[model samples]
Target: MTLRLAFMGTPDFAARSLAEIAAAGHEVVHVFTQPPRRRGRGQSEQKTPVHQLAEVLGIPVSTPASFRDPDVIAHFASLDLDLAAVVAYGQILPQAALYAPRMGCLNLHASLLPRWRGAAPIQRAIMAGDTMTGVQLQQMEAGLDTGPILLSETVRIKDSDTAASLHDRLMEAGALMWPRALAALERGSLEAVSQSSDGVTYARKISSDEARIDWSRSAEELSNHVRGLSPFPGAWFEMPGEKRPVRVKVLLAEPVSGEAAAGPGTVIEGLTVACGEGALRLVRLQREGKGAMDAATFLNGNSLPAGTVLD
Candidate 1:
């Protein structure tokens, strides 16, 4: 039986789940997305990934700023949805909207619930050097990610995984899991379990201030920092330039042992910088006004000789 579904989400990660849920033969009657915002170099207004897909699927879409509006809540209730699935929707649903659907709301969160309960879970996990993380489908409630679990799938955090890579992995997991859970819901066999209270930790948002790389840290820590923030709000250090200091983002890096002979932040070898305890070699870097490049290509264009210090 095709359940009357409504999907709420913003990012492409959510977009994939919405696609799969629809493909599973659910009647995705409507979609709720955040409004289009200016993005990219041109700053052109762009619709959210979910909204774009909903349009492609010929489903009606709504971009409500908030559910505080009584009309917004009533409009959702009018849909008479069997269930509403949320994935990185970026906004918290109030109780009025939470129970608007006949079966209430379900969320696919990136991290294991109660562990990384707040925003930026994927980034925080990598930055904290966590070895495992996964997608959790939970019952939506008034509190933050405090919901009970309906289903979950775990994946190992690889040494080379960045937030971008982990995000894609979790999205795929959600795409598969959402349909499975929906199938169970269709049969009334799905069960909800309370999340364990022992390991609660919040994954706060990544700040712009946290982007600057600190060379005084150990190479291993610096490596995690780099990978954690890679591809967005990247971990950066300032390079000495002829005119002034230049900011460069380290998109990929690995810790190397006993390599640097200089003080922390000093270049001891080609793209290898000294840290407090070890050395980190820059793998991929991006300079302002230029595209991302390998350490070799970046070195070929500019010079960072031995004994030069980066801040």
Candidate 2:
């Protein structure tokens, strides 16, 4: 069925889903995304992934910072949208905007409902060392991700899954499940169960302060932290050197057996760094303003003596 959908999203993950919906022959009447902002070294105006994708798809785009304006609400209502499909739209929908669409709004959330139900679900799930995580399509309510689940599918959290890898996987899975969800909705057979109040937790946005690696943490916990923030806002440690302290991002790491002889944060052997318990072998890392490299290459280029302790 060709449903009139107003695609409301901002990021690359949302763009992927929007593309899939269009490919499935949905009538994407209007695209709603955040306004372009200054980015990169140039600090020039940069369009969001969804904005770029919407332009390529030839869909009309709106970048209202908020839906509080009556004019904006009127414009939204004028679209006569059958449904509003939201994925990381980065704004709360007002009551007027939510009720404007005939079929109401549906959100593609990156985590299992009632668990990690906020902004940074993907990163939080990995950081928490969750054994399982999944995508959920929910009937959007006023509260943050506190909605009834229309459709959901679980994915196993692999030991080596970083935030970037897990994000891509979840995005693909959610896209695949979109058609099924729409079909159920169209058939009037979609069943939305209320999210359980138990095990409720918020996946707060990652902070720059929290990205600093704490060597006092256990090896397993430290490894989780490194992978959780991999590729963006990377978890890092300062390596004290002769000239200055070199800030290095730990992109990939694994917990290994080792004794903490020279206290925590000591470079035991290779890229293995002793923690409060066990040790973490850094597999991939990046120096400040440099490309990512393996432990050997990093060691060869940047001297990391065994007894050297990272500050």
Q: Pick the candidate with the highest lDDT.
A: 1
Extract clashing residue pairs from model 2: none
Write one digit per residue (lDDT tens) for candidate 1, span 87-115: 98988888999988888999999998788
lDDT measured at residue 300 in model 1 versus the true structure, 0 to 100: 97
TM-score of each: 0.97, 0.96
TM-score computed on alpha carbons, candidate 1 = 0.97
Q: Worst lDDT window (10 residues) for model 1?
A: 253-262
Q: How does residue 50 of candidate 1 score in lDDT? A: 98
Q: Please give the lDDT score at residue 124 for candidate 1.
A: 91
For residue 112, model 1's alpha carbon misses the true position, in angstroms, by 1.3
Model 2 lDDT per residue over 1-311, tens place:
68898999999899999989899888999999999999988999999999999999999999998878899899999999999999999998998898899989999999998999899999999999998999999998889999899999999999989999999999999988888888787899999899999999999989988999999899999989998999888999999866889889999999987666758899987889899998889999999999999988998888787988886
RMSD of 1: 1.2
What is the lDDT of every predicted structure here? 0.92, 0.91
